[model samples]
Target: LDWSFRTTTRAAQKLPENVEEILTEAALREAHLIRKYDIPAALRVNTDQTQTVYQQGTNTTWNKKGDRQVPAVGIDEKRAFTLVPSISASGELLPFQAIYHGATPASCPDRKSPFYTEAEQLGFRLEPSKSDTYWSTMAMMKSLVDDVIAPYFECKKNELGIEDPDNQYSIWKIDCWSVHKSKEFLSWMRTTHPKILVIFVPGNCT
Candidate 1:
């Protein structure tokens, strides 16, 4: 569950002193469980959420040599959102969710936009935070599990000829974020999804 960052700048993140030991044990346990349940490659999913901006541009520009002053187009980093992307070990890319920064449904872009239409046709989703931050909320987490995660498992199960996909043993790897580790969330998953084993990536590992 190491996040894949595209930016070149190195983040000042830290890791535990016993990271190697932790990773070794986790890896061993994961391998054992995967083999034990005969989990399909399509069911081993790793997902992550990242803060993203609306426009992608650079502040650097080629200017006159030794110019007294120079300026570059600014990137509107303020218009930010959260992107949740998931992928399976079988190299299948699931439809990602985009949580726009807003407190109401109106805050999101118009559904009539051609871009939105195309994205929707591809099973993409555009959600409103309905909160101060664009980060994923408890409700959003549920939506992600129900709308994207569960359906994906069901589809894979069908392909694997599983008679009971809802109860099939699978693995979902994610970071130990607060919302994800919440007692309520865990209970909901236990009660609603008896299977779909949740695994946490050691904090600050990468």
Candidate 2:
């Protein structure tokens, strides 16, 4: 029999213990079967802040005297929101958060609306600063590895009868594309414990 484990950055960090502990428990539970790893939450950033120009119409008109004409026409400048990496608890990578980052016009006629009305209803603005996006992703990833994965293995150490730290068996099934994204966590696993085996599973193969 084969079992698969999936997690995203957010869910990873939310684990009760460190990664090792969770891994150990999972290993013990499925010791009789083959284990496969899958991480659906990994994301890659393709673009940064992009610029967009928008035009607005103002209501400037001449008064009764018509002495002079008022300048009512104007253009509004808007910028494209940066795309950032995000992971869902179910291991889904949501690459795009919002479609637009500028104001909406009352009379605007556009088939596709970039703004996410649902998100706004949830009280979250779509415009996220570039630095915020970068730091948030990194922080969540770090927490998942350090707090969830690590502790999971620790809990299973005794059950696995893994005396030697280096020979311990711990297989990781992550998206083939996410191996690079999780490189830092993998490295940490090897160096910090030295005894645990951190195998990377590409794709969904069990």
Candidate 3:
């Protein structure tokens, strides 16, 4: 028997039985909704948040083939922040929000800093989480909608000559995170902005 040493690879997270079915169903449903509403690509938006570390020195290690143990480093400092980016189906990049994790507002960059000024000029927000985790809270989600999503939609509605913002139908795609899927969040969205339809991408489907 001959075996060659190789780098270990990350294992698949999900082994669902019907992955094809799941994805096909999701696509079909989304298409149906878009077609039914005749929503333009400008108003259809998809957004996602990702955590990034200040130092990403090492992500891989030499390992034998078929081994699951892959020791890695560069994350011991545990300093990280969450960045949310959004884009429309028409290829319009929307303003995103950056959430800094800290116990207080002091976590935010100095107002006088160039980074702060650049962020402001670019229409992006750099806000503190006011908590231990960079994960979005109900309040943070609200801010995201009010500051980034709502404004973008409003501009698009105006450009489309839609007089009633309340009647401007659109779709928003987000992951099924706990904060986004909570009853309170859904209720708030329905009550405050019924025109914006929220859809959750099935977790771990890709």
Best by lDDT: 1
The order by descending lDDT is 1, 3, 2
Per-residue alpha-carbon lDDT of model 2 for 1-206, expressed as tens digits?
Answer: 59665333232334343566655665564443223322111211111122333553334444667566545555232333333333323353333333243335322224356555554453332432334222224333344345444454554455445555334444333333442347675676567655434433222232
Tens-digit lDDT string for candidate 1 (84-201): 9999999999999989878777877798876887888778878999878899889898899999998899888999998776667989998989999999998998888778899888
TM-score of each: 0.85, 0.29, 0.85
Model 1 TM-score on a 0 to 1 scale: 0.85
Candidate 1 lowest-lDDT run of ten: 70-79
Model 3 clash count equals 0
lDDT of 2 at 172: 38
- Clash count for each candidate, listed in order shown: 0, 25, 0
Q: Which candidate do you rate higher for lDDT, 2 or 3?
A: 3
What RMSD does each model have against the real structure? 4.5, 18.5, 4.6
* Backbone clashes counted, model 1: 0
Candidate 3 local lDDT, 36-118, one digit each (tens): 88788999999998887778655566689999877777735578888899999999998888899876667977788867777
